[model samples]
Target chain A: MTPEILSPAFGLVFDPYVLWVVAGSALFGLFVGAIPGLSATMATALLVPATFFMPPIPAIASMVTATAMAIFAGDIPSCLLRMPGTPASAAYTDEAYALTKKGQGELSLGAGLVFSVIGGLFGTFILILCAPLLAEFALRFSSFEYFWLTLLGLSCAVFIASGDKLKGVISLLIGLLVATVGLDNPAGHPRFTFGLPELMGGAELIPIMVGMFAVSEVMRSSISVAAPLETAQTAIGNVFRGMWGLLKKYPLQTLRGSVLGTLVGALPGAGADIAAWMSYAMSKKFSKEPEKFGTGHIEGIVESGAANNSALAGAWIPAMVFGIPGDSITAIVIGVLYMKNLNPGPTLFVNNAASVYAVFLLFILANLLMLPFGWAAIKSFKQVLRLPRKALLPCILVFCILGAFAINNSVVGIAMMLAFGILAWLMEENGIPVAPAILGMVLGTLLEEHFITSMIKSDGNPLAFFDRPIAGTLAATMIALIVIPTLARLLVRKRPA
Target chain B: MKIGDTVLGALFALLGAIVLWHVRTFPVIPGQKFGAALFPGVIAAGLVVCGILLSVRGLRQADGGGRTIAFDEWARDPVVVVRFLSVPAGLLFYILTSNFLGFHIAASVAMLGWLLVFGVRLLPAVALAICFPALMHLAFYKLLRVPLPWGLLEKVVFPS
Candidate 1:
């Protein structure tokens, strides 16, 4: 929080080398984002080791810039090729693709780009004004409260289940089981390592993430090769033509998407994909032409794309204020912070307030910088579709392999990535939702640790969870989330047909 | 879908049983009633409940002649399965050969092989296979000062 910290960050940003690093990272992010299998989390994870040698401001700037660009670039492929560049774009892929088919591809791309920047800027403003207050509130949480928080995060699996609730819960349980591997907490006993030293620390996040998102996606892409790649025949037209119309027509949708995206981003385990879906669903319900949604709606593209990008900024809030990660990408960012010997949590703001503020400033700057870069990127990415898949897939595979290998330089990690890739493929083939499983793996350890510690502190008091007001509220919220949906369904069924 | 759900549900039930049984081995401290296994055990119970629900739902759907699972669609797409399986297969080969082949050689080979399997062409594949690892090596080893496995190649290239 000292002026010294802020001064160093400001000076660093002005440094020629730091600016180059930020720009390079953003460009790299745009490249990866344009590719269907590559994602923001994977790109961030791949770049994390490279930042080990950088100064704090440069390192943070690179990550923030990359994340923002990656999210924005995701819309490129979704708009042009019907392939979601990132999972966040998955919610709007149908709508965006439909628009492209209708020769309104330029408008869809423009809407995605402009709203993404707007959402990113809005989230940054919120971070600047609200993070400190949230941090202060988070400081009140003790072990008991943390237990509820972790449970609350785990309960996100319910919301993740789009149609089949039971399947989602099952997937979550599998993720929790995977997390139970390695050394046991509290007692320091080994649980499921099976005497393998590589697993002593449990399944690393990087490999699992690479496998679930990148590898599984590649597998899915390999299928339907006959789906014939269609180059958008539409003109690139004026990028800003219909902006006034959209803003005037769907102001409420944009505001709702931005706010909901930010809130979801603040929650641990809930990332941009969830944010986009939630916004899309909300926008659909609020739409005057709700039935015309799936056909090709500009509001769908704006709301979902904006929500996803804003969620990126929202993610940094919890990560910077609390040591806990708000999502997988932030988890990787936390790793980079640890590598730099900068601890994240309440004390981070107190000890390094200026640098943190600089980081907030960088988020806004990065989003603003995205305008020109994203415009150029959209045009370039359309060209990328012309390249033979025969050539592009291999290059992507190389990057994926190296990216996996670079983390820890352990062969075991690479092998783990491949193994999980196969498992992910099988799961997808079987119709299992991979998102909840990944969320489970991410939250599993935290949930277990908190549950054990809270029990120990209470000396066997199960009611200790309800004893604390915050804990009780969180627990109640989790229960309500589960019950409300079932109740609604029942009420609908009971209604006259 | 019915068969798949039944199998999955049974698998979850088995997992729950295993967790519940395993927790018995850990000595529960006197004051602390719950042991290290308690939390996992609770999650396991939840899994069992969910699994049961899935199995029941799947069976009911099947009995009602609901939407059937498409086994033919999955069978038709063998490349998807291969591409998926090849990642782990390639990684295993990389890990097994990294020491003898050296990090750079092993990684380059792995990358090349993965590209071929993924249907990438020869020239760009070869170029990327070499450049990506070389760049990573320079960044991690030379710039960041993190030591990567040099293996037998390092002694010949940069003998101390």
Candidate 2:
């Protein structure tokens, strides 16, 4: 990043129109994220249609700003209602809510707000430093290397991230199957279009994502519509009061959380939720007062709140450089990037250097803006709780409808949303993790394309996959990731027997 | 609804089998052994193996009293069931009607049904049903310039 790149990037992000978008999306993110059922992913999903009309910078800006705000705002509902507004907040919901019950809601909410900003900025700094370096390194990668890397990312999602390995693979296969629907493959043959013209373009990612993340959530929320929403604390006073003291007191925990959150977020198949869970566990393990964890303690809240928020930026690293999403949010973002002609790979860095830097600036600006916007959201949260889920849910559905329709200007998108909505709902009910399926859908075509190109280059010799040094190392790592774990499990089971 | 792993596994296996059989007919790329069928074929093979393993594990487990399917606790409540069903039904209703009724009418009617079904008061539901689509129109249509179908409203709003 030169001064020239930085200057133009600043111009792109600091434009009046772009700033307006960032501010509007900040509020939109807070509202959706503060609501118990609406997630940060849904915030991104619903914003996609609006972004369709935007240029690359503002479009990227809108998603970046919204998701960052949404991740922080999710802590609001976690503190007040014991219901996590997003999956990422679920890790520390109990701790935050316990504080609310103990009449220390201000402390928990304040720590969440402050630490989230720190963690987000920390992740963004790391992203700024590492992404360009990685992209430069990746510029030398061939089709063979890419084939292995994409496979490695997907394998990580299934083997390392998901709980039920068998079910995760099944979900991933379903996504891969879905990806083979259109004629966009190397062979130019449609696999499962069922003779529809719309199927020729392959399954649209936006509607399918809206269905999986948003519609499925609405379906789940609909069943509980009769259940009234009541906040544990009616009045929150001065959330910023004790935040500085807590930060000074636990600076090591703060740093550790931010580092771990970034690493976890950078990993494939895992996002903020996993990062929060892992960091919260790590915090407990390292804490002197581990017993105070679930009992109104603000320590876990501080660490994991930062973890989840920072994970948002961490997930963008692989997404920007490799076109491999770190989580479901970037899975959607990759599609948007492709749509905007800012294809997410090493070439994006070389060709769109200004845009890449613009994205970095947006991340920094978004995190800094979180303080005031999040403060306002916390103050006005009681009013948000009063909005009936019954009315609000239908309104969200209407938005989902418009969002889905705006993607293709066709009812087919809506139909796809409805179908996948039901499919995702069923998949979740069946204990199948939906994230791998999403990763599969996003990477499936790319994986196939690279594999075919590699095969053609090597003239059908499978051993050529491991001929390149980088590809060989990645292949070894992927194999060990799968084999070593299963082997250990088998050995342990045999010993027990 | 909760389905047994055995049943789910079988469904996946059946799906994989169907895909595997179907893809065999896809023509190969000239002078190359691999074709479009290769990727899907590999995935199908994986699905089959995973499905069988899942079924074996499910059968070994003694949960659910050996039942293949079970409704959730909330499934017992007719009202909750209706609420859950209404979501998909409403979205489907919009998909089928959006072109003819237009986005406004289709979306409003669907939202109205959802709000009412979810037990909001009649007046507020009616008001929201009417207002929300208009709000979306301004955002999606006016601001974003999405070519939202007018359906029946096309005649009245932009009569030639």
Candidate 3:
């Protein structure tokens, strides 16, 4: 609130160079996210090398702007082609596509854009208000707390994933297994590496992600490659139209989604994808008409879309505060923070208050800019779908190849992508959800590291896990979530009907 | 595959057992009782229990017919099979030949093959195959400064 904090950031943030960086990165993100097989994370991954040349504030702004725009642009393909442009959009792809098929494409696309801006702004406000206090609180977190947090995120995967819970659990285990494939861990001993020197570093997450989402999608699209992608509506008239009415109708859902998305997103391991999935599930669970979810209901999309964008802002809270990434994107951002000499942690607030505030300002700017840029991207990209997916698929394949290779500048990355692509295809073919596996892959290392560190610190005392109050509360929540469901089923069976 | 729950459950249970057995060979740190294998072991245990539960439930369910692998209607079509195989083949082609053929040449060949097998006509396929790689070379090599393999073109571009 002080002018001193604002003064230095005002000059840095408003510099034309920074603004241009933000704008250019935003466009890059939009294009990448609009493509069917590409994702926001891939956009961030590609930007890392380029970021080496830029200053800290611009580097940070590029990420904040691009990710927000990409998240919004992801909705474009999801609605038009039933192909989610990013994994964050996957949670509501069917709903958006169904609405498009029903000739309500404008409403779906509009709601995604407007609610995204609202939810993003809401999360930014929360980040501005709560980050300092939350960062103070996060300083007290130990490996025990983080272990429970990772478990909670893992549970969110099961709770939110569609279809059978058992299948979801299996998919998660597969991801966790993949996480175990490298040499580095708490033990510093390689397991399941199968002697490939490249495997020593562990499964490269980008390739795995690109493989799971992009490559598997390509394999599935193969079934209908010849069939032209058709849409019930052609012109996207007044995308901003009806968004206000829908927002008014579901004000609570919007607030609920934004709040939940931010909270889940602020958690150390859970990211925007989990936030969207959990919000979508919670929206259905609490809706007046719960059964309306999957068969193309905008109700779920509205809530989840808002949730995912808010989650983006929420993620930076922990990254800025604790240097522990709230998600994968922030994980990369943290490295950039250190490289830029803006080290994260409590002292960072005192040492570099202006740079920190500049980051906050950039978040607000990025969300606001999404309104115009998102509209333009949506309008133009709709026309480009005239090209058959047969041609489009090859372009995506090349992007995937380049994206996977660009991550490590190695062909091993490409091989990993193709191998995982096949594995993910088989898993999906067996009715297993891919999202939980993705979550597992991301969290698996953190989970192991926390668990081992906590156990060693406690000298193998299992009781120590519940001794700490915050850890105890999280553990209690975890136990109740598992136990209460079985207890409710038992109680219902015994009662009588 | 629309695998029967019992079969899927058995598969998972077997996977769990294999992991559990594998953990026995993992080297535990001397001072710590738990190590890298402990987490995987716990997950394996959960997988086994869940797998058993799923299998039992599947066995109890009535009318378990047609619960095995069942291909979609599109799977019967030859074109679909070729289209499906084309993507993986393109990836494999790149992996095996990218260094020898270079990124541009390999990607063009892969892109062209994918476009054709997926039903794009030869003319458009040829156009995209050639144009796309050039665009990629500009962006990745020139813009980003990534040293994509030049292969045969290496001698002409950077003479030894």
Candidate 4:
């Protein structure tokens, strides 16, 4: 359905209480996103329980608003400090930080905020128009199709681990292994529990995610004991002075980034980080001045930030329609929906059209809201860089603990967070990419279930994967991606160094 | 890269062997010939092949001065590793103590302990420890009604 048909449901979000919730959540998201170590996923997870008393529209509004704001807010830390506030922001961090060093921090933040809003709105527009069509197409995905989809996601681990593909594969395997810890799929017997009752349900994703990203970050920060960041002594001239110039300079770049971001975000298990990187790589490829990319270029910031933010809206497209989360943040949002007795899928659109429409509207409103909020946040958050590490670290630690505990109200979750934090640190030290590991954890169960189901339906014939046109195409894509990279490397090696 | 590849490869191989071994114990279904173990078995085989490839690559690269450990960096800052390790250790402790102290109290205590271990001062640590959990209590319990465990202090404070 078009956005015009969705207008009636948009009125539901205008309720006073819902607006308040949205604003409050947006502010909270800005705060978390501004923090160096805090992440949007953690913010969403912590806020999930807070939505229990609200109606579905308000709950979803709070999540969508907060996520949109948080995703943009991530650029604040990346611009002012070298550290990324969220994983999604990591792609643009180098360019943003370089610009910051050049006294163009405000310009970078401004561009990020403006382009992010544009990207987010564009994605929401696509979501509003294409969700139904995509949902219909998604319904065509049977067991074999799901297996290929999961395989495509698994192959992305290689793309992410471009420097060391083998280590990437291993990390992915570890994640899958971790997923197998709970009850056995077919027989319902425990596989790797080893008599631990707490593990019967396997490792909880929320705690593991928080531990891996947040706790591990906190630990890394503490050891290094970073010096207080120094902001530009002079004011960044006219936040919007060169906006028209930027649009003119990189029209094609921004459009490419937005499209790439939306597509990647729509893929289950691929989130904004991947989108940002893909966009950046593509932008570099098409740039007339690729050499200037890492040397404090506004195009890099605009491209990556816009792509990442748009990817957030794109993530919701698959999630709201197919009951599949595009990333960890969406996974938490899905959990919240389930808690509210709102099952997301084809039935959700038919039953709760208003709530879904409200979500779509919130995506636009959140981006519009960023115009003012992001401007003020950029100014104020720069002040936060002056806070001593000793003072700030403890506060972050408390938040991490509370965030972990709030997940299941179980200490086990907290413990899992800490364990995973340490494991993450060790993995990093050993040069293992944590992203692939997380991808494995997120996609493992889905892959296993679909694989077994497809196998059973085909009577153990693996060729069933090739029988479906769409599945075969996706599988072919995966094969091409793997083979083409190796073949290119071989060709390059054959040339004289 | 060498150390990373070898460790990852060996670990994968071991995990694959374990998975393959475990699958043999499951009873096979009659007509549905591809039982529960089929998926895991395929994954295990893939893991073994990948693992062997990785190990060979690792061994080949190990002799080229690429396998050196970061011993100097480790020695310079053992606190980094210790602090990193503390996160999981503290989490385990919190999990063990949550039922006894309740989720809130256990969470607060764990936060305080971690902050201290990470080298935060006592006053700020104590204040944050208390306030953070109290805020969470308000947010989760009072607002959302998720029902956090209150333990012995429940009767005196909440009285609900």
Fnat of every candidate, listed in order? 0.48, 0.89, 0.73, 0.46
- The CAPRI-style docking tier of model 4 reads acceptable
Instruction: List runs of model 3 lying over 4 Å from the truth.
Output: A1-18, A28-67, A70-112, A160-163, A230-257, A260-308, A311-359, B65-67
Clashing pairs in 4: A415-B91, A418-B88, A419-B88
Q: Candidate 1 lDDT, tens digit per residue, A87-186?
A: 8899999899899899898889899999999899988888888888877888888877777766666666446433466776777788888888777666
lDDT (C-alpha) at residue A462 in model 4: 88
Judged by DockQ cut-offs, the docking class of candidate 3 is: medium
**Candidate 4 lDDT, tens digit per residue, B1-160?**
1245665667778878888998788667677766657666777887888888876776688464333443435445666667655656666776677666876787788778777776778998899788877887776677766666767666777776
* Candidate 2: tens digits of C-alpha lDDT, residues A1-497: 68989999999999999999999999999999998889999999999988998999999999999999999999998999899999999999999999989899999999999999999999999999999999999998999999989999998889877889989999999999898889987789877888888889999999999999999999999988888878888878998997889999999999999999998898888999999999999999999999999998988888998888888999999999999999899999999999998999999999989999999999999999999999999999988878889999998899888888888788898899999999999999989999999999999999999998898899899999999899999999989998999899999999967
Decreasing lDDT order of the candidates: 2, 3, 1, 4
Full ranking by DockQ: 2, 3, 1, 4
TM-score of each: 0.88, 0.98, 0.83, 0.87
Q: Rank the candidates by TM-score, best first.
A: 2, 1, 4, 3
What docking grade applies to model 2?
Answer: high
Residue A429: error of model 4 in Å? 3.3
Candidate 4, residues A1-497: lDDT per residue as tens digits?
56654776667888889899988998989987887766787678657546756788888888888888888988878877677878789988889889989888778878888899888888888898889776677777787877776777667655643357877777777787777667757667576776877778776777787677777776666665644555543365557767778888878877878888888887766788889888888888788889998889888777877899888988888778766667667877776787688877766776777677778778888989988888887777756555666555555555566666666666667777877887887787677777667767766777878887788788789888899898899889888978998899899999976
TM-score of 4: 0.87
Task: Kindly list the per-residue Cα lDDT of model 3 for residues A2-62, writing each as its tens digit.
Answer: 8989989888899999999999998989987887666786677666656755889999999
Which residue pairs of candidate 3 clash? none
Off by over 4 Å in 2: B64-66
| Model 1 lDDT tens row, B44-144 | 88887887776676667645432244454545567766664565666677778887888788878877877776677789778978987898778667877
